[model samples]
Every structure is written in structure tokens, then in C-alpha cells.
Target: VAEWYALVAAPGAMEAREPLRDLRGALRAMLARVRGGRRDRVGLGRAEPTLRWLRSLSAFTEGEPGEGREPFELPRFWDALDQTFKVTSQEATKLSLAFSRPPLTSAEDCRKLSEDVQNAILAVATVYYWLPKGQGTTLRKMVRDATTEVVKGMIQLTETILSAPLESLSQEQLISTGGVWEACEQVSNLPRDNQAAVASALAACLGVVKDALEEMEHALVEGQDPYSDIVEDEELGFRGNRDTYWSEADRKLLSSCMGLMKASKACLKKVLAVVKAYGKADSPEQIAQLDDLADIANEISPSVDELALSMYPPMNQLAVRLNAAKLASVLKKVLEITKTSHVCPPSEEGWVQFLTGAVDHNMNKIKNFTQGQL
Candidate 1:
């Protein structure tokens, strides 16, 4: 009967409470029979005490009869027991399903599944810790180990996703995709002792990517004057060589560059406005605005670099010297814009270096052209 009761109360059993009550009743009857037996019998004498203990607990299964137990109270106890079983079954099912799934295919999928897995882990841990000491030890260990593995996998997958190139993702994707920030938030929901290492690692990863993105955005939107050395070279060359002259072509190029600079500055202002709007909002509309900001920033980035290159003394010495202070001022504003934008790199460092180098090469070309003219 005890074996039967254990099987009927197993986690997957249906109608657990009904069979459990029946088992208790059968035990109660058997105990009564054993108690009525001859106490002098050799085998029955020692077991009688154990039988009495089971009978005492049977009162819980079948409330004290004729003792004025409130009618409402019985139903409440049954309802609470049923609810506990239902919740336990649901959580168990979720944990089983989460661990049974195949490997994740994409970052988005990974992000979603990681949340599910983490939730399941928390559920299992909650129940395990509530169990009395020495009870469910094996199951608790299994749950703890599973939680550790799932958390580790989640952290790794998040890093890989965040490490993807930002330029390749649309603004909508960037806003929706899970990465360091999302990972940190999810990890923070876990038990405190489990959170520290993962949270710290994720925070560090976010910091590095954020700094890199700021640097890249600064370069793209405002342009870095890589040809400062070229400016010094020109100043020395023209010091006593010849009067600096501006030809019609030179004047037209300078004007075009300045016009481009003015337009870029205007675009940056609009982009900043969009970014401000994005930051202030937490709705879907604001997310869509972020896409717009990204698009505008991308479109204006090249133009900004071209304008800066044109002003580099190596490329157009007269243009650089003519608007030296303004050029410096524009570059400074670009850095400020990038600093405030809060967008970070989607991937690694190679692309950032390439973009910066490409702008430098253009300035070098201008330097080569000026040398040829001389």
C-alpha cells in the first residue's frame, strides 16, 4: 500500500490527491486491525507503535470526524492542496521542455529561449529550496546544475549576438535584438548569488562595445582630421616659398566643402533631435524613430568625412588654412554628437578602423595631388 501510494503521488500522476486520500484511509483501517491484535504476539508487539503513528497522521487526510470542523475549512484545505499540485506540475513541465530543446539558431531566438530557460530555472530553484532538508537532494542538485549550465549558455550567446556588426542590422533589428543589456537584465532576475559573475561580465562587455561605438560614430559623423601632419608640412613649405594663392577651382572646391560642412551640421542637428526624442520615449514609436536616426546618421556619415577630408591641408591646403578654426569646431561638435547618441558598435574593431583609414587615404590623395602641382 505504501508503494502504491508513492507511485500514485509521483509528479506525473493524474488525480494525485484522490488516490492519496484513499491510500491514507486504507492505512487507517490496517492500523486499526493491527492495534486490535494481541499485544503479546512476538512480531506485532514492536510494529504496533509505528502503526499508531500512521493512524495519527491519517486524521490530516480525513479531518477529525464529528469534531465540529467548519464545513468551509475542509474545502479550503483541499483547494490549497490542489493548487499546489497544479503549480508544481506546470513548473516541472516547463523545465523539462526548456532543457529538451535543440540548440538555438539565431540571436533573436537565443534571446527568447534564454529568458524561458532562466524563468524555468528560477521556478525549479524556488521549489527545491522550499523542500525540507534531506528531501529532494538529488533533484535539487540536478536543478542547480541545470541552472548553472543554462546561465552560462545564455551569457555566451548574448555576447556573440552583441558582437555582431551594428551596421549590418537595421535600426529596428538593433532595437529589438537581445545583447548585453538584455542579458544583464535577465541575469539580474536570478538569485543574488548567481548574478554577480554573469552581470559583471555582461557589464564589462557592454562598456567596451559602447566606447568603441562612440568612437566609430564620432569618426563617421564628424570626421577626424588625420592629416594634421600634412597641415604642418604645408605651413613649412609655404612659409617663404610663395604667396598663397586661391584659384577659381580652389575657391569653388572650398565653397563646396564648406557647403557640405554646413549641410552635415544641419543634418547632425536633426539627428540629435531624433536621438533626444528616442531617449525620452519608451514606446514602439520611439523605437521606430531610432531607425530613422540610424538611417540619417548613416546617410550623412560619408558626406561629413568628405567635407573634413576636403579641408585637410594635404588634400586642399588653402581650404584647410582658410577654415582651420571652423573645421576644428565642426570636428569637435561631431565628437560631442557621438558621445551623446548612446549607440554602440554592433560587432568588432576591423570595420571601424577601415572606415577611419579610408577617410585618411582620401586626404593622402589630396596631398599627393598638391605635391604633383608643386
Candidate 2:
């Protein structure tokens, strides 16, 4: 019960290295108290099995260390386990005395009581000793059997928590920084104060949208196919008309933008992972490969941004509907580093088609929202 409470109330504490020290302290105290007792207090019959168990535990604990083992040395760990074995045996004696054999009891009852007491003592001894031995084979099986019912009780509670919806998040809280706010201000024509307030709110919403999309993407990558609330949110927003003069072209730009963005993040993840595995490549070819990848990611960024602009050139009498400049600059720097010199500028046809589709989607959503406001 104490172990269970420790697990429940302070699960994080289990991760720290000091618990073994506490166990050692408890064992030492138990040993001091037990030694003060009369020599014959624990009979030979009781003492023999207890001593054998302690020896087994000590042998296992003092064995040669394995690679990447925990910091606690084998000797110290063995001493601690040996002490705990003594403590558990002492407790078992008290229990045995309290439930002493009845003189006239049936032979079966006496046998069963003895077996129960022995099993209890063994179980406690096994756990105390096995922990330092790195997932003991026999002990794990015993613990699994003992904790099965307790674990079952926790299942429903765990399920409820796991199934719960993500907590509500404001737009400002979702984004990493105020970059989205600046973009919103550039695009929206609201009065200064209104734009400031609305952009702050919208930036937060955009941040949340980005986070939700990332979660979905990650889940998809992991083969989890998480059910998402983003689709519902998207449907509730204004739908744009795709037939506008530049919609087709503008959408192509957005596609390029997305590709460059994804590639940048992907390349970086790969580079970091490679560095971790191989540890600073010394060869020129290896260094070149890493450098080339980085440059390619950078170059792609600008090309996509340019595509976005060409597709959505400012219309006469109409303010620009998008801001693609900042994104373009990021891409230019990437291209310079990759220095692949072979650039895949956004294809005109592809840009036109992409812009057409995006404009249609955005216009329909926007029209729907405007009508509702009326």
C-alpha cells in the first residue's frame, strides 16, 4: 500500500536516483533494531529460508555491471538489498507470531497458513532485492501478477484522461511569437486599434490552427490518424470564391510556399538526426552533403515566396490580399546556402491552378461569414 501511494502521489519521484539511498537508510535502521533482539527470537526453521533468500539477493546485486547501467555501483546496491531483505524478514516474524498455528487446527489449515506467510515474506524480499538487478526475471513476473488488479482499476481513469479534448488555447498563446500579428496587420484594413486588437486575437487563432495542423501531421506520420476538430473549425469560417481573376495563379504560389516550408523543416530534422548519430563528420564529402542539403532548403524558401507574389500581383483599385515578402526573404537565404544552382522555380501552370483552388475556397468561406454578419 505504501508503494502504491508513492507511485500515485509522486510518480515523478520514481525517476530520480535518490530513492535507492532512502531504501538503504530504511534497511540500516531495520538491521539495527533487529540485532538488539534475543538470539532465539527467530527460530532456526524461520531463519534458514530467510538467510537463503538474502544470499540469493546479495549474489544477484553484486554481479558484474552491465553497459550503460545506472550510476549506483554494484557493491553499494548489494549492501542496500541485503539490508532490505533483513528488514522484510523481521516484519514477517511479527506477522507469523500474530497468526500463530492453532494447536487443534486441521492439518490443511495449518499448511495453508504457513504457505501464505512464506509467500508474503518471499514476495516482499524478492521486490526489495530485484530492483537493483535491472528488471529481475522471476521478480517481474511475481510483481505483474500481484499488481494486475490494481492496474486494472486505473485503466478507466487513464482512458478518460487520454480521451479528453485538448484544452482551450488563445491565438496569441498558440503562436511562438508576434510574427503572425505583424502579417495580419499588413493584410487586414481594419482601423489601427481594431486591427491591433483583432490581429492579436487572430494571431492567437492562427497559432492554434498551426498547432492543430502540426499535431495532425505528426499523428499521420506516426500512423495514428487522430480524429481532428480543425476540419470543423475550418468549415465554420468564410469560404472564398475561386473564380477571381488571379485566384488560380495565387494558389500555385501558396503551393510552392507550403512545399518550401515543409522541405526546410524536414531537412533540418534530418541534419540534426544525422549529426547525433554520426557525431560531426570529419570527411569533406560528408561535410559537403550536409552543407548542400542546408543550402537547398534555404534556396527553396525564396523561390516559393516569389511564386506566391507572381500569382497574387496587386489588383488595380484593390489593396494586396496577401503578404509574401517575409517568407520570400527566408527562402532566398536558404537557396544561397544549398548553392545547388539547379532551381525549380514554381511552374506557371502549377501556380495558376493552385491559386485558383485556394481563392475559391477562401472566397466562399469569407462570403458565408459576411452574410451571417449582415
Candidate 3:
């Protein structure tokens, strides 16, 4: 049995070896108890058969017993394993009951319970691994159902931690990021198809939330705006202006641009909620809502971009007239709009370059006009 385990653990094993490792460890522990004379003769007799079956199973190992023997068939091997160690509906039901209970109090107790839960999940997954293509036997269905329930339980626990306020979360919970996603990844390795979809949803949900948290930290803690330096340069140019003359149309245009940016920010806030809910969306209706939300987000970006671009020509004309104060006011408004919009730029430097380019062009035009006048 140990040799069989060694072969399974060795490099280039054709199949997943996790369950085999667990099974081997359990068998070794059982053997130790038997050697200690803790189990009765009947227990030893039952274990002997299983041990002999495992020994026979070891023959499927790569280059085992002889050099030119027939290659091991993976399906046949899994089928034999399933027949030897059946996972009955009763076992799955008992596990389901245990998993449904509230979490334990102590850390040690929780760790032990977690191990048992993992073992139960692995047992169900083993049975799932051997199921014939498109075949839905009662026992196989029971195992799959149990696996789903257990996975859902794991997701709920992980989300409970993730959804909580960060300051209120325990150190352990904070450190255990991606727990649900990792569990889903393990389940995705099973032969079942829906496991992949579940894994994808969990991953997307976690990714969106993590990104939002990072963005929030950047905005709040860092007190840094990626567009700050560019806006400051434009502000300096505006401050250097000698004229204070203003027009009603200029005021209206500035007001309209600021209003459009504020509206875009509101739309972005709504899109964020949709993004957060997308992972938890189960039904077709909820999925359709996410699609609609995505469409709204896509629509808002271009509209806001158009509004930002519209201010450029007018601000440029003002700059040419040496109306530095109005130009400065428009640039300041642009900075305020960009900061409030929370729209990430296409690149690391963001839209600052685009905004500053317009200002630079106006400055060059003013410089040329003065030179021509002289």
C-alpha cells in the first residue's frame, strides 16, 4: 500500500493524486491501530480484504510489476476504487447535517471540523470522479448534491467575512482572503460541468470587490490624485493671467460640463453596485440585470468623455485671447470633475495627459500671437 502511494505521489502520475494521498494516510493510521491490537479480529479481517484490494490496485502504477505490461486505464482504475470504497447516500447525508450546523467556538475545534469537512467533500468528489459519462446514478447524484451543498456552505462562510466591515474583521479572517475562490477551484477539478460555472462566478465576484477596496484605499488613504500634477500646471498658467474679464456663455459652459461629470459619477456608483452583485446573481433574470447594468456603464463612459472633450475648444479660444483667469477657471473645473468621476484612465498616467495637452496647445498659440504682435 505504501509502494502504491509512493507511485501515485511520484512525478508524471496520469491522474489527480490528492484523494489517493488522503486514502493512503487513512489506511496507514488504521494499520497502526491494528498493529497496536486496538481493533478486534473482525476489524482486522475486514481491513485485510481492503488492503489486498489496494495492493492489487497498485499494479496499475507506471512501469509496475513488469516493463511491457498493458498501460493502466484511468477510468477502470477509478471504477475499481469506487467499488472498493463506496460513498453511500447515508454518509453524504450525515456530512450535510454536520456542515449545516453553526461554526464551533474554539480555533482547535474549528480546525478539526474543517479537516473532517474537507475529508467528506473529498469522498464525494472521489465518487464523482468515477461516474460514467452522462450517467446519473442515484448514488452519484446524491454525492454531487452533497458536494454542492458543502461548497455553498464554504462560499457563505467566506462571503460573511468578506462582506463585513474591514475594521471589524478578525486578523485570521482578513488574512484568509480568497478562501471561497480557492475552494471553488478545488471543486472545479471534479468531472462535473457546473462546478466550473460556480467557480467562475465566485472568482469574478471576489475580484470586483477586491478591486473596489483597493481603489477606495487609494482614494482615501493615499490622498493622491493621479491627475494632480497636470491640473496644478494648468492652474499656475491660469493664475499668471493678467485679465479678469468674464462672459455669461463661459459660465454656462463650465456649469454644464461640471453637471455632466457629476451625473457620470452617479452612474458609476450604480454600476459598482451591479458589479458587486454579479457574482451572487443566480437566476436568468438577475443575470439579465447585470447585462443591463454593464450596458449602462459602457454608455456612460463615452458620454462623459465627450462632455470632457467639448470644453477643450472653448477653453482654447479663451487662452488665445489672453483671458488667463477664465482659462484657469475652466481647468480647475476639469480637475474637480475628473476627481469626482472616479473614472480610471486608459493608462497609468490617466486622462491628465489628455487634459494638459489642450492647455499646452493654448499656451503655444498665445506665445505665437505675442511674438507676431511684436
Using TM-score as the measure, name the better of candidate 2 and candidate 3.
3
Question: Can you write out model 1's per-residue Cα lDDT over 67-168, one digit (the tens) per residue?
Answer: 333332323433443343344334333322332323313344333443343343333333323322122222223334433433333334333333332213
Where in model 2 is the C-alpha error above 4 Å?
1-240, 243-246, 279-374
TM-score of each: 0.22, 0.19, 0.22
- Worst lDDT window (10 residues) for model 2? 186-195
- Tens digit of per-residue lDDT, candidate 3, span 270-303: 3343234332333444334333333333344444
Give the worst 10-residue stretch by lDDT in candidate 1. Answer: 191-200
lDDT per residue (tens digit) for residues 1-374 in model 2: 95675455343332221222222232322232222323244333334444453454344334432324446343453454444334433433332232232222233443443344334333433433343323222222233332232222122222222232222123422231122223222212221121122223323333443453364345334532133222333864523432233333333333444443344344333333333443222343443444344334434334434433333323221111222333334434433332331221233234323433443454344334234333
For candidate 2, what is the TM-score?
0.19
lDDT of 2 at 8: 55
State the displacement of the C-alpha of residue 294, model 2, in Å, after optimal TM-score superposition.
Answer: 18
* Model 1: lDDT to the true structure: 0.36
Flag clash pairs in model 1. Answer: 164-346, 166-346
User: Sorted on lDDT, highest at the top, how do the candidates line up?
Assistant: 3, 1, 2
Cα lDDT, model 2, residue 304: 36
RMSD of 2: 23.8
